[model samples]
Target: MEAESGKHIQKAEGTKLEQSSFEPSALSFQLKIGFDGKRAANNLTGLGNYSRSLIEHLAHQFPENQYLVYSPKVKSSKQIDAFFKLKNIELKLPLNGRFLWRSLNILKDLSRDEVKIYHGLSHEIPFAIQHTRIKSVVTIHDLIFLRFPRYFKYIDRKLYLLKSRYACKHANKIIAISEKTKADIVEFYKIDPDKIQVIYQSCDDSFKMPFNKETLSRIRATYKLPEKYILNVGTIEERKNLKLIVQALKEVNEAYKLVVIGKQTKYFKTVEKEIEKLGLKNRILFLKNIPFSDLPGIYQMASVFAYPSFYEGFGIPIIEALYSNVPVVAATGSCLEEAGGPDSLYVSPTDSTGLAAAINQILSSEQQQARMKKKGLEFVQKFNNPLVTQQLMDSYKALLNTANY
Candidate 1:
């Protein structure tokens, strides 16, 4: 049956493909959609940002449709607060079983609410959702845990594999954030390619907007940022390969400092030990608890942005930096090429000298920076909010239109 489904598969480059236009006015009625809201409401990292941004854009673009976000609890943050203020979005919580509701019992509430489409914003959907009338869609962000097993605990890898395989097998449709992820799903889980749709995600709207010099200066003063620095963002973890950037700083110009912003993990000690060995304590600055609003200014003021992650489902920071008009130097082994586009420079993840050369190549030449900035801005427009939201809404409508459903 899965092989039969592969017959309808179409080739996709990143998220670009022929898609039917989404017109809310042409629709007979409004859509009542449900999403896995745990990350949207609580997580402060990549998954959370993806969830919040997608939901916000969908709401803004399709106000007539009803959005139901289900989560066990909500945390108060500037982003979350702003999300709640938007019209046409409602937060749903279980009356009880808050602990296991999402995994074990959320389907009951989904059925009761008559959610026409249920999207698991993260990987897994509730078990037995295939038996329900609600058409199910699951977004498989990445198979990083499977790709880089050494970075994760043995049990964690097993659990991730189990849940992801189950989701791919059961969900009526799958949304792959990148073409690479779509390929990984087919390769690892043996799922039908036709079952997956590539839909790129956009960064926060704040990154796309311009910040004035005064506002940038205020952010610089607040963070005590250096006059010139290279920026790297994402959780400081083994797979993120922050250590590579730390090593490359040895070869980069002494005048340019490296600013690291992220939630640190045990792997940070490994990077710190390398920093101590290299005697770069004064050359590196690590910032924590940065407000989301201030991130754009930080990126805008940077000399260059560096991301040497060993692997990713999709690299959001590359687009964020591109939108901020900063040239990017990202690692080459994974899907960074797709996110960075052809204009951004790439180096091997383990090549410290090459990475440093790429960074310096951008910083030392104004002409090079301007060209990359121009081309990157042009490439990133394909991931804009309206186009991405339309693709998503069209996916939902297409799923509902299927006669089998």
Candidate 2:
């Protein structure tokens, strides 16, 4: 790959001019970014996925910017095919190292390399090194436990709020993943709106419908997915409201099977038991730990993509479903309203009957389904990575101008 001329890269003559250039060679300023690698090593859930994807994008977009991804385990097999694009971005995985050591010693390491900024991709900044002179920015994905504490178990909920409070109080700038989350931060933490920047997360471009017949057939056989199944992607949890979806699927026409693609948790035994009682053994299929590459085929082959989660900072799979031109049925709560709009077939998350009726209506009406395919394609356009990535780059420019970072 030819190195993009730092001067001409931004001046390329295309609508998606921003994406054409990926140059890490002319790095003018160094950035040392720390992550919750200890937490990341355990389970890569919402915040972990958010941290990994955005940092990958940043590393690609500003190749000239020295990118150091500081993780707890310095060495391990956490290779992301998504990051195959950012070959130059250094991964400083300090595996088996104490979290305290990385949190405290990271800045000194950055200083030795003369790195200008230290960004914490997670909410918890280094509490031990807050007063350091290095420029700092923290990404607060969401204050979920702060707003919906009851959704979390006691001990996990307690620790999150306390750590978030400290990070918000001290970090030079805060990156809020959604506008709804920024509002929560402003209200709960009482931070200035100016201090909090809304950086919408982008759907990984790999989640597009693939054309390879051999690959599609292999994935289909492996998952045992029907050619015409309703798809739901995301972890099985209470907030995901999988129980209602399972219940609603029972009422849908017997021809349309329900296929769920994600990991099931112990708390979601309620959903698992409901599936058993309903005798949906053949009607419903659950494929956990589905590979990222295979997901686009899952979305493309679905009769309709349903996500009835009660809350979200931003719904990535909704956008993924839309891009695949799969008709979407998203919940009418929280960020879904902002994320899906008319592109999705919407119903209140509160009413299971309402959800069931909507599903029946979509499944029954071919005309309505046709309209949704077009609407979803239109809705997904705004979420195209080049646009969102440029917005993120603008945020980086703003942070640079802030004089604080």
Candidate 3:
């Protein structure tokens, strides 16, 4: 949130090399950026990952600007200890400690702090602050509610549409995670294409580093993880299509089990019913609520990672699997290709036979697995921390340069 006398900054429309770099040490301008920290505080899901990673990188890579992260209540500061170590970033708690200050009172605080840029990490921006001088940016991760209406309750779907549409209409610029998301924004909300910028997200750096044998063995013993399994990590919901993977596993004649790591929803009952009907109890395993620190080991130990999600803004787990040196077999549709890369196997979303064939093909051959692993590692290099951090900083700089303060 650098305060400069400018009329307006337009959307960024250049490659990484084309943009001018802002020197972090010299800090030519004074920018104070405020972010909606609600998701970053209590959640460990995708939203939380996006918020925490972006904020941490901004503070680390661009130390010149000040950052304010506003949240209702922070579960524990220790979870994000690396972020707190940075002097330029501060987390502000709600005054009452009992209410979500975002809708009610966060605006007054932002105005008082004289924040120049307010970013809504989730699909929301404060309505009270929209007309003010503060320039706004909103990140819309996905339009899942709109894409799969039956998955969401009526009230939740309506609210998501309302908030997402309002934010898109009012924000100075929108950050879409992928081209698919950008297209959906334009189609669903009728927003101008020029107003949106697509920025791909990277998984945490921890995923890239190799885990030691002792730690892996401890986690496996603690969780009772199988030696060989097809890993799938995502929420257990209809749109995620976890049941399809289970169905496909039945046809594959291998000792490798299907290990799922995600929170279970009511829709999990549907999957459970299928599992019981098939009596494939020993073949399918669900590991819910595993510690985030242990996820890399889980991914590394898997025989092959399978993601049959119907759609996603960008699939972080696929990238995580790539970094872990695990071969991937994902669904064909949507942005999974961007995450899985060309070397990995792809099958139709609904075709169990196709999925089974792909899984079997990878498991049967050691040379194929090695080649895919090598290619996946090479392909995922673009999503490394330095590249993604630069892209994000460029977007922030572009927004600030084009806005009137």
Query: Number of the top candidate by TM-score?
Result: 1
- Residue-level lDDT tens digits of model 3 in 361-390: 999999999999999999999888878889
Candidate 3 lDDT trough over 10 residues, lowest sum? 1-10
Cα misplacement distance, residue 192 of candidate 3 (Å): 1.1
Better of 1 and 2 by TM-score: 1
162-227 per-residue lDDT for model 2 (tens digits): 778778888878888778888888989899888888767767666654547787788889888886
Reference-based TM-score of each model = 0.91, 0.85, 0.89
Tens digits of per-residue lDDT for model 1, 128-241: 888888899999999988888888889989988888899999999999999999999999999999999999988877898899989999999999999999999999998899
Candidate 2, residue 176: Cα displacement in angstroms equals 1.4
Candidate 1: regions farther than 4 A off: 1-29
Compared to the true structure, candidate 3 yields what TM-score?
A: 0.89
Tell me the lDDT of candidate 1: 0.86
- Could you arrange the candidates by lDDT from highest to lowest? 1, 3, 2
Screening candidate 2 with a backbone cut-off below 3 angstroms (N, C-alpha, C), the clashing residue pairs are 24-63, 24-64, 27-64, 72-94, 73-93, 73-94, 73-95, 74-93, 74-94, 74-95
* Pick by lDDT: 1 or 2, better one: 1
Best by lDDT: 1
